[model samples]
Target: MSSDSRRFVSQLAHNEPVSQVFLASDKQLRPNRNGNLYLQVDLSDRSGSVNTRMWNATDNDYKAFDNGDYVHVEGATQLFQGNMQLIATRIRKARPDELDEGDFITLQSADIEKMRTRLTEILEQIQSTPLTRLAKGFLKDDAFMDKFCRAPAGMKNHHAYQGGLLEHVLSLMELVLAVAPKYPQLSQDKLLMGAFLHDAAKTDELFYDRDIGYTDAGQLLGHMVIGVSMLDEKVRQIVQQDGQPFPERLLIELKHLIISHHGEYEYGSPKLPMTLEAIVLHLLDNLDAKVASFSQLMADCPNSESNWTQYFSQIGRKLFKPEKED
Candidate 1:
């Protein structure tokens, strides 16, 4: 897989020859105005994805590959809608020997082990006994930890890479630790716990083995609702294990934090942030996600000579990429 000759999807430049192995996705076939068949596909690697098309392709070519198949593509980069797109000339499914599984998974650049240790350190700072116990209930679950350490925060939006959920949570925790003191009325323990559990259900919401996609359960019930259920189940287990009463009021507040972290009803929260901790959790969570989204948008900007990226519908505006100072 590493011949020192492979070109990744991110390295593609305008009008250059591109020959590489990529995981194929979003396959569709349609005819031009002339009624000639053409293939439309998305080629992806760990770095990112690029939309591609093969003109004059036949149905056999379309049938030769599936959505998740690893394929070898020969194409040239072209500007489409002010962004880079690939105009493929040749495409074939890659043999098992040619496909490298590593090439297909996007990962966070942060050190996951260090992040995990930092998370543990932060959790230890929680002063409330019940909250501490509840947080530990999750930390002690090896099964959940394995998935949590690997799950992405989203499919395409902010922190949409392997280890993204952990990275995002850790980021929120760091911010809470820094700002919790400034606001004395906020419950320090609950605020930090909310940040950790806000997107914890994403471990199940997204299926990321090959490429990220929504699970049936995720489509049916979102992470916010699922997170409340998970928190309740954990509380029950804690009580059953210790034979001690877990505070019911504390549990309700924690559940509220998860359900209302989205901040508004339209954003999918069934309730708005009523508690100070919940309100703080919403703000910090949005801050981390929006910053991650903007950072990715800037990094993915194709034009090196230009400072402005193409208009992004998600951010609802084009971003300025300032030149680096030497």
Candidate 2:
């Protein structure tokens, strides 16, 4: 594949001929109506993704490329069922050096440096001594900070792009600060600490240095448990440094916030949110994630002229995008 110039998936238009290389985010081999085998691949760039069809493909052709591999694709965009689809004429794996890694990885569009500063400011605003120490412990860890600043919040759910975890954390912190005043019973310290640590282990849960996927521990133990473990370790280190034990009650409560932030057991929380702070954290965390997911869906909606998006399996409803008049 020649690396002359590349067009992003977001820039594609209907019937536009394209000969570009993109990261193969996903792959599936399926049978059409006549029982003909075809390859379905999700091509992506730093911008967005598009589904492509490689018809009349054999098992060998399907085996040639795997998800997370960069592939040189020759295709023309077409409207399929009112969505943009790529009809691939040629597909083959591209060399690693053929494309820049930064070009394929989708990053949060926000100013990361500004977000980092805001993150520090929020951490500083935590009044609880133990909680601020714990937050700073994490912020000081270079390895953890690097991963936190780059890891996606999930593989596909809310904040799934690079630097998404930080964005999610900062947004939730900002939201909690805005709403906490009305609910005086809500501990600002606990809420802010919980917001920062809620998905902290997502740094370990997701492997996004290359492709966004789950780590072995992420699949087995998940982020909640991992986060509790992380908290335990950090608390131990803090106790070691300060020569005073981290308060047992505070430790227990913080861990509870992390594990129970999911709100419901079926939704992956090990325990229900029983405390006022926990309940508030659950509501705000869920609110930010759901709203971010909805925003992402709307932004990625293919039909620009349509006022509604396709059905979303997560929410079980298609979102209405009402047009604005001048």
Candidate 3:
């Protein structure tokens, strides 16, 4: 299909006929009540993803494509319990010539480069010598920097696209710069570093070549624990270069920022925010993610005429859409 004629997932409406190629992930084949197999998968593009189900699927059909493969689907959109999903009649692996790769890319190379430049500019604002050294260590690692610039901030929720991690960190750091001045007691340097490092390990935690998913380390240790270890590695490099020991208390505080940034135990934080910077980081992190999620929801809502979106069971309410000013 021509790019101009392509309809994105976000533009799909109820009862709409869909014939397009999408990057597929999270495929599962399971037996229904009648012992017939059904294929469940997520079809995604740069806009967003839609959960898809294809009934009466065979084992060969499931093996025809991998999680990261592009698939051509013939389906119809439907509302299932307040959510948009696709009921597919036919699905098969897409040929190389069938689709354009640009359709699946959310961030271009120029966008990533701009964000990388902004990230370096913000990290340069750190005044603490030890923190500066730690930040420099991370920046100098070309391999790590590549992944940091390319990894998604999440698998499905907010900022779930290539270069999303860098975008999120830059936005969070900007928020730190803005909010810290209002609260003079908070250390801007510490908070900025916390924002940079909070989700840094997600680069390693997620595998995002075509489809976003968790690595084995991410499933076993998670990004928070891995972040602490990453911080220690950078700190070790700094110590070896300067022959001066990094501050014990500062290292502990940085590690605490990563582990507690989730805020609550139910949210996967191992410890609650104890310090002023930690608490601020947690709150701001949540604020950024929620704003992004809500914004995406509004943009992706199918019923453009409705003032409120369909009720989302995850959040337990419909989101109100304010009318746009001309």
Candidate 4:
């Protein structure tokens, strides 16, 4: 059945089997929680969102079930803890083709292909050899390219979802070009590679199945670490096949770009950006992510002169309607 955007939870489908169900994802996990416990779910459909919770004490969210698994939320809509959450009596895995495309994931309605065309145009303008080659190889893979283009750059924070990676990459590159000219201290080539290839590993690591699900690699190593491994492996392969000396120094510096892109070790970086490019990449990444998340907040929910939303941790601000300009 087609999930109407207007209907977040079908009062009619309350007792029926959960036909058009949106799945549970790791995106809902709160910071401090017990192992086997109930979870507050971000039940998303194109229309809007409803909070879902599994109240059954026997549930195993920390062990058996996981984030990003498709599940049938079968039960009735009931208020719990003063919130609108579906009180699920039973929950089971949802499979592919079990839902209409629109019901399962939230994506910008913009044309994905057009986004790709524009992304490729920016990529071709890159002058660094390894950066150019890396971008080309990733964009060439039919399956990977499709997922990368469509996947959110992140589950939250910044450019999140299909075309999100491309958009974020493009934004970082623009920032680098605009800023690099002023700082002769920064190697343009190194900065470009670090900026362009830093997140390329996310193309493979993150799988947007159901709702921005991580592949096994993502679950384990994360995009930054996996990307460095990917780069190292590819460099080894290139050096082995041909006796030509690969740019080892350039490659090492590029690795730093990925390692320090997260800005802090705990956040996932090996070190804060020592090189100018690394610093720039981190700052621009933060800027773009915060702006995108904030923009989404403004667009999805308006002030309406009625209500204001709680502070968004991603954007670190309360969501409010933008004032109209004459």
From the highest TM-score down, the ranking of the candidates is: 3, 1, 2, 4
Comparing 2 with 4 on lDDT, the higher-scoring candidate is: 2
Candidate 3 achieves a global lDDT of 0.93
Q: Give stretches of model 2 more than 4 Å off.
A: 1-7, 11-16, 28-37, 78-83, 95-102, 108-110, 324-326
When superposed on Cα atoms, how far off is each prediction in RMSD?
Answer: 2.3, 3.0, 1.0, 5.5
Estimate, for each residue in 1-326, the C-alpha lDDT of model 3 and write its tens digit.
Answer: 55788999988899999998999999999999999999999999999999999999999889988999999999899988767899999889998888899999999999999999999999999999989988899999999999999999998779999999999999999999999999999999999999999999999899999999999999999999999999998998889998989999999999999999999999999999999999999999999999999899888888788999988777878999989899
For all candidates in order, the CA lDDT equals: 0.86, 0.85, 0.93, 0.65
For each candidate, give its TM-score against the true structure: 0.91, 0.88, 0.98, 0.72
Give the local distance difference test score of model 4: 0.65
**lDDT, residue 84, candidate 2:** 80
Give the alpha carbon lDDT tens digit for every residue of 194-298 in model 2: 899999999998788655788899999999999999999988987888887788998899989999999998898999998898999999999999998888778
lDDT of 4 at 20: 48
Which residue pairs in model 2 clash with each other? Answer: none
Residues 1-326, model 1: lDDT tens digits: 65366777667677888877888877889999999999999888877788899999899989988887889898899877777889999999888888777676555345787788899999998989998898899999999988999998997778877788999999999999899999888888889999999899999888876667788889999898889888889989999999889988888898899999999988889999999999999999999999998887787677767999898776689999888999
Q: Model 3 clash pairs?
A: none
